[model samples]
Target: MPPIQLVVFDMAGTTVTDQHEVERCFTEAAAQTSLPVSPERILAVQGMGKRQVFQMLWAEQLGEQHPELERHVNTSYAAFRHILETHYQTQGASPTEGCLDTFAYLHKRGIAIALTTGFYRAVTDIILEKLGWLDGLNEQHVGTSDSLIQASVASDEVAEGRPAPLLIERAMHLLGVTDPKAVVNVGDTPSDLLSGQAAGVRLNLGVVNGTHSLDQLQPHPHDQLLASLAELPAVLEAL
Candidate 1:
């Protein structure tokens, strides 16, 4: 059997943990600030970078001119970040089941495991450090969480991110993986699914372990679906 080359990931729902508390956190912040961000609004931006979430909510709820929304989101997000940093290491933000085992197995098989989140470097590093998730990873080899940043990469690198293939392309290049047929992308969000599809990766598997329901996630043409990352190894074995 041929080996899987690179297994790329989206961090929040893919590796960090689940969102049961996250909504509560958002709700608490919204009530405190009296902003328009609701639990569902927060859910819409679950896999996004923290700042991006703020920006999205700002635009949708407050408009581009409202710096107050930015302030509110930052302050609110800071509150959440503090809590997460304290507890997320051991508890995880909502890491999918079996993700650790699958990632470990991929490493053992010499399949490069790469990750990208919507986070900025500081936030990304904090989560990785707190969770000890980046313990064995090489900083140079890992892709930075620069998804929403302009000037993030050179034009030759990738086309776009999420629903676009740019981030995966960058990860593949950094890992020296050239074959689209030998790679897979595992994620819990539809954005991840569409990103894989855009990158032309060999497999794009969706997991219901994140905020999105299967019905909403099903329209994107995923190659496979599972209830959790726990099913990943067996799925790979079958593949």
Candidate 2:
């Protein structure tokens, strides 16, 4: 087996601490904007880009060609951004259990680490800054080996979000990784696993400790399902 050169991780539920606050924020924003989307609907799209989530929802509710589709998408997305930004800013965020240890282990092994997120640039930066992970990244969100992480790719930066391979591909491009076989993709959602599989990565891993439970993720195609990020090092070692 080829050695893993990079590990692309999902933010929010995978690496960061999330207590369903994101879902609450989305629901509140939808209500405030009169989008009338259900909490179940919002939860279903957890790993997708925020704007695209609104776009999908509004298109479903108002019809793809509805005259007010764009307007509704814009209105609801703006509200969601505000609500999510405020929640993260005031309530703050932290690394999930074993997240830092995983980072350290990867660093010692010379495996590059990149963060891919459903969030746009602004909110992504806010969370990274709060965690002090933004220090070495340049304007493009790419950092050197000396930095905390090698790269940060926000969904807005790519042409598509989860379930699309662009985000993972972008991270590979930024990190000078040439083969999907040399990569490992880790996240807590089905879309995350789907994206990795689409990218043809070596491992498409899911962790159950986030927003999704084991039952929710079992049906999705993945190389393995972990209990949490804590088990990742052992898995990697045996690989």
Candidate 3:
């Protein structure tokens, strides 16, 4: 097997500490917009793009051909963005347990690290800035050239988000990694696993420290399911 040249991580659940705040934000936004969405429904689509989530929920509630579907989606999504941004800005962001250690481990081995998120660029930036992960990022690509992480790909930067290969493929492109088999993709959601699988990454790992538990993610296709990112280095070493 080829050595892992790059490791792509998910932002909210995989590397960052998310206390279900994202789901809360989504639910609050839907209520603010007079859209009734169940908490279970919101959690089911955790890793999807914020706008796409709204679109899907609205489509389900009002039908795909509803004349006002686009308007409702736009309104709810805008509200979601505001709520989410304010939540991160005020509540602050923190790295998941052992996430920094994992980054250091990969850095010491000359492996490139990248972050991909279902968030748009603005909120993504706010969280990275809070975590001080943007210290050496390139303004042009909005990724690091010399920092521990090489790239940060937001859902807004790609043509599509999770469950689509675009985000992973874009991260690989930005990091100058050409071979999919030389990559490892890790996240905490089913969409993250699906994205990695679609990208043909060598390792499609699901970490249980974020949005989903081991049992929740067990139904998804992944090479391995980890208790947390702390176990990642060991798994990589074994592979």
Candidate 4:
């Protein structure tokens, strides 16, 4: 063991396979407030912050109809929150394939585990409750930094979201991490790969059990790629 301090995990795709419900909730909510026509467009904007995702989805639905789509976005996000509370948060979602054993191995070894997501407080709570791992989260270790300075987004965790390292940096700080290069970032999307890259972490493990396939994830190939988290231990041992 090299004394890995924190194993930072991505909330949605990394920890749980709830993208289907998550996407549907957003699309439905946005639609209720006059937006989107298809799930494919929303999927294309995957890995972005909720607000931007909503804006993009709504913009696509409107299709150059409104010069200012903020109002519709705002309404949709609100409705999205409601939908999440009812459907997504209530029903919950499944964890990524092999996530449990991998996490258990780390935690059992006294390695710290942290979850970072682009989701907001309320909706994320539903997810946490569903996973029953909310108790493991250290509120202080969470990151919602970029949105703090970028006020136009209307969310403290929406500014740069995943693709930026801000969230990872914030998580490391809260975890009392000293060496940035020692951390490991595991995610299911290219955005997460980009974020881990920005954090300067020496290891970034990408899994194909979520958003992208080998062909899509290859452009931003991770340090290691596997079918699922089950391959993580071997990857770590090799590291």
| Top of the candidates by TM-score | 2
Superior candidate under TM-score, 3 versus 4: 3
Assess the local accuracy of residue 11 in candidate 2 as a C-alpha lDDT between 0 and 100.
95
Question: Candidate 2: where is the Cα deviation over 4 Å?
Answer: none
Cα lDDT tens digits, model 2, 1-239, are: 67999999999999998899899999999899988887778888999999999999999988999998999999999999999999899988999889999999999999999999999999999999999999999999999999999999999999989899999999999999999999999999889999999999999999999999999999998989999899999999988
lDDT of 3 at 186: 96
- Predicted candidate 1 versus true structure: per-residue lDDT over 1-239, tens digit per residue: 34688777777666667565556655666566565765666665555455555556656777788768667767766766665555555554434688777766765666677776655455566666665555545545353232111111221233334556777777777767788778888777777787788878888988887767788678866998888888887888787
Each model's lDDT: 0.65, 0.94, 0.91, 0.68
Q: List the residue pairs that clash in candidate 2.
A: none
Kindly report which residue stretches of model 4 are placed more than 4 angstroms away from their true locations once superposed.
1-3, 57-67, 136-159
For all predictions, the C-alpha RMSD in Å is: 6.0, 0.7, 1.1, 5.8
Question: In model 4, where is the ten-residue run with the lowest total lDDT?
Answer: 146-155
**Per-residue lDDT of 37 in model 4:** 56
Question: Tens digits of per-residue lDDT for model 4 on 1-239?
Answer: 34566667776766778556777776778667767457766665566677767776667666657867778878888887788778864576777878888877775555666677767767666766676655534453232221111111112453567677877776666657777676888887787888888888878878877776777678894787778888887776676
Ranking by TM-score: 2, 3, 4, 1
RMSD of 4: 5.8
Model 3 TM-score is 0.97
Best by lDDT: 2
